[model samples]
Target: MARIAVIGAGMGAMAGAARLAVAGHRVVVYERTQTYGGAVRGFERDGFRFDTGPGLLPLPAVWRDLFLKTGREPLESHVEAVQVDPSARHVFADGTEAALPNASRAGVVAALDTALGAGAGQRWGDFLVRARESWDRTRRPLLEEPLWPNWRVLAEREPYPAVPHKRLLRTRRAGTLAEIGAWELRDPRLAALLESHALAYGLDPRTTPASAAVLPYMEHAFGTWYVRGGMRELARAVYERCLARGVEFRFGTEVTAVVEKDGRAAGVELAGGEAAEADFVVAGVAPDVLDRVAGGLAERAAGEVPARRSAASRLTVLLALRGARPEGTAHRTVVHAPDRDAELASVFDGAPGPSARPTVTVLRPDDPALVPDAGHEAVVLSATVPAALGAAADPGSRSGDPAAGAEELITAATRAIPGLRDRLLWHEVRTPADIEAATGAAGGAVPAPALAAAGGRLLHPANGTRTPGLFTVGGWSHPGGGLPHAGMSGALVAGLIVEGPEFRGSQ
Candidate 1:
């Protein structure tokens, strides 16, 4: 078996290590931080525990596949997930609130029709049906396969021309979210709502790809879920599974560089000049950071790097509230701005001034066992903000003042939820700088490869020029970000490493 070195210890690295270990390969995961989990890390302040990253959990089957492949069961031991009803409460500028149901297309349509107006539901249903078809046709060929030779093979097996008459690839790169929604949905409110969904990827609807329409479909069709404990528990579960599979984990050991022998990667050089050898290396850190670590490898492979429409960087506040559950508050809430375009422009322009109002998603742990008391609440408010607000002098350094940013975020969040400030017992804030420092993510990108830029032939790193033994994996590669996609990226890389070029050749 190969001596593999998995870098970062994030979900992607963890998944890769676990899978490699189960395959009987000697695997060692080197993490720069004192802890694992990357973006999924959690912390506590006062009597409140907060999950620092990934507030929601969807697609449980993805986790199941990761565990089952390693001879484990995620459902039986890892997480207790409950499907959320009325998945999210979206609040508009006119004070109209739409509680979206986590149900079938017809059920969702009925709810939308009742909430919005007559005929709106059927219109949405038709759109959903089309989106579902897009998802079904492309999920395996586009998302499941590695973006390398496999993509080409899959394309050949089912040529875009031969596939169902739906214009999947044709619409791959179309108008912005708002434009598409405006043209597709007749109602202005529904169009705005559809456009606003782009915020889920930290993107503005105006520039977001139409393919992103699949996001709402997946959430509504499969349902939005929450872990019984917290999202961080998912990372812990993966960590435990890795240990069971005999994977060696070394935390607090930062990877300073990827050492190369001739033209291929030999291993990694840890902080303070310690070096560990491996026949294969999979880096699960951000692409920009990976570019730096690989010593311009990313720049050299610039053509391969998926084009990115700048992803929204967040300014998040974690609040510990002492009060009974607030009435009319769903597990998730989205507060829309009067002009989302201007709001998004301010963030992108690095002028996320003190006055910008952001959509807030509050998570109240349903499991009594996870929290100390029913009166206490753990709330995380996140909104898109300027990257400069969280900038640091060094990429690897921790934030200079996280508390200051936290205060600013808290002040903003209170505006959306009245009396929110008064209820806070303790709080923490995470700026883009803080997230990058803590998780080694590029520009605090929660998930690498922003949704807008990942599409068609460019989805996978394996498709581009490759060094003899050097390979890349993680969210930065392709299918793109999110926990499930990252895990799948690692698996795809592993398959390529083991099976050679033929693995993804049929894609």
Candidate 2:
């Protein structure tokens, strides 16, 4: 049996470890932090619990596949996967609100028709139809399989069948997401609803490819899910699965370097000045720090997806409220920014600044375990912010309150949560600084899922590298970020290792 050493105990790394161990390999995971799950972390105070990372999970089939491949126990047995009905409530800039049902095209169309007047729902439903086409075209290449060697083919092609819109002189199909909104959706509120899907993943709708329609399609088609208790439970479940597979984890043991022998990844060097030899190595850390730890490993590969220097980060405010959550409240609510242009300008990924108002996502799970009692509630508010102006990189961001974005988030949240400030007992703000500390991501910038078009700028590096026996997984690599994509990254890495370079796709 080959000995495998994995760097980082994130979900992706652990997922790979579990599958490799089940393949009868000896795997040891070294994590710098005292916990697993990378950015999937939780915070608790006075009976109130908050998931500091992703509040809801989309495309849970990825995890289901992981569980099925690794063990007999279904994912449902470990954590209660509750399908959130009325998937989400969106409050448009025009004060119009729509509650979309989970995974029901007819229900969502009807709801949008009722809320946005005639023709709006039809437009959105049609858009989703086109988005589905994109999903069917790219799903295997982007999510299920290792990134193709000729990835530019995926990059240059736009699978989204955009409707022909005649703009005065020329008749052309919409190219970017913004064009999809303006040419097809027509209504500003519908545009806001469409763009919010991209925004939630830190992608700028203005420039994101039309192929990104797959983002919302994945949610609408699959449905959003919440783990019982908190999202941290999902991380705990995966960590446990790795342990069950005999994967060894050394927490708080940081990896300093990726040692090489015969020009192949030989093992890893630890911070304590000890070397652990292994036959193969897998890295799940962010792309920014990957070079530092692995000595420019990604750069050695030819024509791999360029490492994303920076992406949008999130500013989250965890609220401990005094009152019980009202029954019938939607599981998730998105309050769109009142001034779209202004908010978009300020929240640009590389340029951090305060927006007068920015789009905010408010999550209030119905789970009683999150609160001390029925008399209290746990609420999480998240807003996309620039990757920089972080205390770690910007002098200005450090000069003022690092959590200054909390006020902006709270202000935008007032639309979703009535009397929000009044209901609060206390609140804690977690900035990009916290993310950088937790995940070692520069400026805590979160990577978005890989998208076709935009000349392949959004695609991440390939799973295999120039250095043999070394593979990179997680958000920084192929298939890109988000829970499902990261999990798939692990699967791809295992496939490449177990089946060798000829590995095509999971059966």
Identify the leading candidate in terms of lDDT. 2
lDDT of 1 by residue, 183-282 (tens): 5676766776776566756665665556566677678777888877788888888899999999999988888888788877788998899898888777
Badly placed stretches (over 4 Å) of model 2 are: 349-354, 391-400
How does candidate 2 fare on TM-score? Answer: 0.97
lDDT of 1 at 138: 64
lDDT minimum window of 10 residues, candidate 2 = 391-400
Residue 106 of model 2 has an lDDT of 93
Estimate every model's Cα lDDT from 0 to 1: 0.66, 0.88
Give the Cα-based TM-score of candidate 1 against the true structure.
Answer: 0.86
- Per-residue accuracy of model 2 over 396-463 as CA lDDT, tens digit each: 12223544567777878889988988998899888888888899998778888988888899888889
